[model samples]
Target: MEQAIVIRSEIRKCMQEEGFTLGGFSKATEIRGSYLSLLLNHDPHKYPLPMRHFDSMIQALGKPEGWLYECYVDECFITGKTDRRRVEPFLLRCAELGKTECIERVLSRLMENLNQLSLVFEIAEKVHAAGNQQGAVPFYECVAEHEKHQHSETLAISQYRLFRAALGQDLHKNRFAATRFAPFRKRLPVEYQLDGLLQLANTYYTLSDWRRLGECADELIALAKVVYQEQHQRKTSKREKTPLNTERHLVLYYGKGYLSKATAYEKQGLYAESKKCIEGYADLSWFEGLDEVGKKEVQMFQIFAVANSYTLEILMGHSYVLSEYTNYLSMHKHEILSGLATILESANKYGFSVDETLEMLSKEILEFKQREDLPGLGWRLRFHYYLSIYFLGKGKIAECIENTLQSLDLSVIINNSGAFAQAVALFELCRGQATDAHLNNYKGLLEEVRKRERFNLGFHNY
Candidate 1:
């Protein structure tokens, strides 16, 4: 068999195991960076890859003496001098809905990264079995909780969610994903597990498990209180009369517990109770610098908290807190027209319309798209989400669909979980499924807010 031109999976694994980047490897082996990149990406052409470079790669990757031996009996020639007759582009085919052929090809190739491959297989099986998002969450949560990289973990959740929510798969089942993730949950460090447990609790809440949510919220608050008391006293943070450390600890802890209670009450239609909780949560903390950037972020989130209060009001035409926030947003934030802008416009917070929202969003999209690509691509994700909403409100479902797809795409690249969640949720709403799973997600979403609250109380005994 011709030596594998670019066993990309092997190549990537080798690099990862060696703990070396392409640039570092090139420098160490005296190979040109350009040549190394081609090898990593598995360029089909590119002059058949110099033998010297391959030898250097083997040495750098600490390959055994069997370096030049047959690794794959079959080769997937995606392009450039590949064994096209023998191998196939399984991933692409899998996405194209040819799973049988894809599975056959995968089995034939025997791709070694069985962990991720297993996730894919599991996704397909569950999608077939239970037929919705709830079934897949367990598997996805298992994968997500252990993923070292936050982005990958978030992405796996996103992909599974989008696929399930898109096709109304939420109709199949609705239950807590905690048990599914329980096996691997303990494997994570305590801190990491706490963070994930908070999320898991939140997820269950969104699924509408109020009882479980209470338990989760209490646990989170208790944990936060412990972390807090261990750090500093609450008197300083809450009273603003004690040590600076104390004040900050109180603010964060109290904020955590209050926020969760607020969200939970809001979901229960306890409007006054929810608002009170949120108000308590948003109290001026000893931390949170009041700089323009800091104030802007806080105010934006605070607005969302209040907006939750307004949601029931708006649907019932009872009241609206958006007007003041609108003034603040227009005066303090004419430039940040992404999700909030859309939500504002949709709520007519600034007396804007669907048309105005579209115009504002279109402009913002190009502006952010023009900015240097970087991590935390918040603006990009927001623009896409709002654009979808704008289209949907205009009665252009097709355009709405297009915008949603765009939002999902940008959201993934930027890893904006909230924006991604919104778009995915809205997409389900539009599909007319908005089934039990969608409702369940709303419940889960509420727990996320409450977990933060529990963390503040110093202990969730209350």
Candidate 2:
């Protein structure tokens, strides 16, 4: 009440000092004089000003944006209840202006009545759908924090959005987000469940947790099949068609289900099982209801199937396919990073020399190293790791140590503990051969890892 009164009084004082009558002020602000007079004279405790009018007055008075927004948070309440008409727009404007304190104040008051959860969730969806994902985090966090029903769809969707928004280059954070959202995956709408499972599988893939990745892939395949079958049945029957609003074309979910499974198996060294899963999506072109996008996805899967077949052969010690695989990679530049990694790994495993192949793809390797995207970084880390192994196997001690240090640096940057452990162990085994410069670089990387660990520990503790 006091804050509201102070705002009104300040407006009145500004008008009086500027020698503007109510009529003049109203004209400048494009508000009616009668309404302006009522706003100034009415007891603010009983009749709070609307946010739009207050905004107009601020602009007319040449005040900065978000002038009196702190006090405006009070105006959003009337008689101790929220006025949705005022609060919603005010909240959005606050978000636009980066008035986080005001947003928190308004949300704190709004949450006092748990009935506002639906409204809050709606605003979160609107913000998220607008591509302002970070802005929607607070609203989603508020709903997830106060939601009493663990099984509620609202809670599940909030968790799903939070999980999607939280994903980034940080593997540790991605793992945490995946774990937090996994329990709510089944509770989401079927459409969300499909996308959520795919996200989980990808996160697990990044973490190198092949077992969990396979589980999510299996669940994704099951749900996608159910949805696909239901759609087919609806099409065949006379029932009115209802569309599913998924993030991607329906076939993507289905194809990714098999693709992710194949990747999980390949990572686990189950080449035969991986080949079978690759074949699962190899001919999804026959899947019904494929639009242009779906057709493209099917074509992409076919390409992946061919590429991964070559990869499996290489991993299984078929040195005969090296030239063919290199040709395929050259034609499809996008596959070069992973392809080269696989080639290097096979070379190390089979005790074969890939010196000519490496020299030929030197440009591609440099480009891969320069890429900073999460997937690019991930593959680069693997490339360096595998390249180090190849170098060690070839008795090139200097090249091995350099690649090992590079891989270790990347592993730390991405917070990939599994790769970091492997790189550290390899480095330890080769420590006696490291030059002074190599040892210095290794010590520096270790310091960086220690600093990051301390920061993570402090954050979690707080």
Candidate 3:
């Protein structure tokens, strides 16, 4: 109360010094004079001056954004109770202005009563829905921190949102996030569970954690099947279908379940098991309730099945498929990087020649090398590393060192520790053959890694 009164006094003093009456200030700021008078008088019976009006007053007075925000925190409460009408917009404005301290102050007060968790969660959802994902973090964090129920759906949703918002290019951080959110995956609403499991699977895929990836994929498949069956029943019975607000088509989840399982098995060298899983989604023409979007997903799965079938055969030491695979790649330009990586891996493993394939896709390879934000960065890294290995095996030291350096640089950017280690090992093995330029590039990449490590450490410490 005292802080609110003092802040109101400061506002009145500013208005008086600026030689503006309530009507004059209201005319300038377009706020109602009665509201301005009520605010200046610190009327205890009414609510605090809304943040929008406060911001307007600030702009009219030529004060900077977020001026007096700290003191305004007191105004959000009346007689030891939060005024949601006043506080909601205030917190949003604080977020917009990067006023972390002010937001913390308001949240601290709001969390004193555990009943405010829903309000905080709603605000967080609103912020997230508005595309201010980073801004919603504090609110979600607060609710996650204060909620007393361990198995509450609200808590699970908050964890899920945090997991999603935390994801980025950092593999280590992504792994940690996946671990943190794994337990809550089943506790989320079915809709959220589908998306959460998919994201978890993807994160594990990137981290090369095949075992966990298989686990999430299995869960996703099971849940998606049950829901898909129910959806089919609803359609047949003419009942209102329960909305499944998943990020992708429902069939995509079902297809990905099998696809990801195949990938996990392939990674483990279980070619036979991977081939069976590929057949799971090979022809989903019988899948029920497919709209245009679902039909598109089915078509995509068909494409993947064909490509992956070829991949499985190649990986299983059938070098005869190389020509057909290259032809497929020529038809599907989008699949070139991943397809080439698979070809190189097979070539190195089976001692087959991909020189023709490489020459054929030289233009695409050069474009992939130059582009940084391609969808499959890990594939790019693998392609470069494997290409380097092929060059080394053929005794092309110069080309080998160049590809090694390219792979090393990408490994650092993607934070793929395994790829980084492999690239580093390959470079060391051929250090004697490296030209001066290669040595300099290697030194620069090492420095970049060092700086990145230092930054990560500092961020964690802070």
Candidate 4:
């Protein structure tokens, strides 16, 4: 009698996990509960119910098949009157089961398919809301990426709406603030080209690939100038001028050209030309009118100019300090002291010391030490460092070690990051050790140097 009666029950596991019963799933998926109950429980292989009903039930459970299978009474799973099935059910099932590996794999593949993106962004927003900014950035990036075959007029129109919605999301994303594609920049033809150029230039800068930086900067400046001139002409005929903010940025762009020019010259060992280009870097009156944000930005740029000036001088094999060579040393105590320190270091490291170079360096160092007047000049002023190093070259290890320790101490007191960092950077680079043991000792010394006065705002002390 049990076999004779046709027993029926809907397979409700996937539906229940979606927070639904058969009827609830029906309402969500727009399928009648009775029909869903029939479809889930039925052996479709035998009775062969409607394919749309099967798809609706799957969709109600938040499933997405690759393509809907168009199956009639008798059709193959692959080639029947149907689409290729996506089988998103396995992923949802894995997620419900809390199988982490399965969830990661499923999500990875799902993100790759651009069609499954809206849900991806929704999931990312949830993750971000749950305080996983690092995790959310990649998902946001994936959502913003264009589908290879799907970008057309309809998609272009929808992109702005989606991007705005993504930006408006209430979630924690600060850690991902610098991530690529999280905010989704405009992809207008003009914007798209700008993006490409920006990327090209950034790659060169990050890698310190000067040749490429020069090439890209040359191209970008040409393009930007032409476009800017056209816009300038158009605005001249307009009733009102371009906004003040826009005007400031246009000026800043010119400054960037100068910066790029300076960098090129510096790399080419044309130190004077580089210094000339960057000398008036912060004297822009445009900075005086800047709002808080703009002022902060200009300040950072000035800091960079100072840092670049120091680097160029170091690379040029010249002691602008102690060697009547630098106009900058004529202006400030800081430049004079720092330049003398660097030149002393160079004389000791490289055998480029003229008799006067060593004599003048020691006198300057001793004079600065006796005065003990500079706030951050403690380690820098201690020890007639060049003579000490010259003695080291003549195998005076005890005196060399003593002078080294004094310089290291001064590095700590003044918070002179460049001096501290370069000491370590150079020790690693220099291979002229008396023995393997001594080499290891110097390496250990580098490791023990404590960095104080921490600030990531970058340094202004050139």
Candidate 2 pairs with clashing backbones? none
TM-score: model 4 vs. ground truth: 0.40
How do the predictions measure up, each by TM-score?
A: 0.37, 0.92, 0.93, 0.40
Give the candidates in order of TM-score, highest first: 3, 2, 4, 1
lDDT of 3 at 46: 68
Tens-digit per-residue lDDT, 1-462, candidate 3:
777777778788888889988889999999888877777785654657777888888888888999888888988886567788889999888877778889999999998888989999998898888888888889989988998998999999999999998988777687778888888888999999999998988888877788888888888889989999898888789777777788888998999999999999999999989999999899998998789999999998998998999898888879899899898988888788888998899889989999999999888887886556523777788888999999999999899999999888887776766777788899999999898999999999999988777223222110
In model 2, what is the error at residue 128, expressed in angstroms? 1.5
lDDT of each: 0.48, 0.88, 0.85, 0.47
Q: Per-residue CA lDDT of candidate 4, range 29-101, in tens?
A: 6877676566556554433344455556656556555222212212212222222232233333333334445
lDDT of 4: 0.47
lDDT of 1 by residue, 44-159 (tens): 44434443455566677787533532333233432333332333222322323333433444443433443454545445345535554443443343444445554443444433
Per-residue error (Å), model 2, residue 33? 2.2
What candidate 1 gets wrong by more than 4 Å, as runs, is 1-179, 182-190, 201-215, 233-261, 264-270, 284-323, 330-362, 365-462
Summing lDDT over every window of 10 consecutive residues in candidate 3, give the lowest-scoring window: 453-462
Q: What is the lDDT of candidate 1?
A: 0.48
* lDDT pick, better of 2 and 3: 2
Give the better candidate number (1 or 4) by lDDT.
1
Q: Indicate the TM-score of model 2.
A: 0.92
Candidate 2 lDDT, tens digit per residue, 83-162? Answer: 89889889878777778889888899999999998999988887777778888888899999999999999999999999
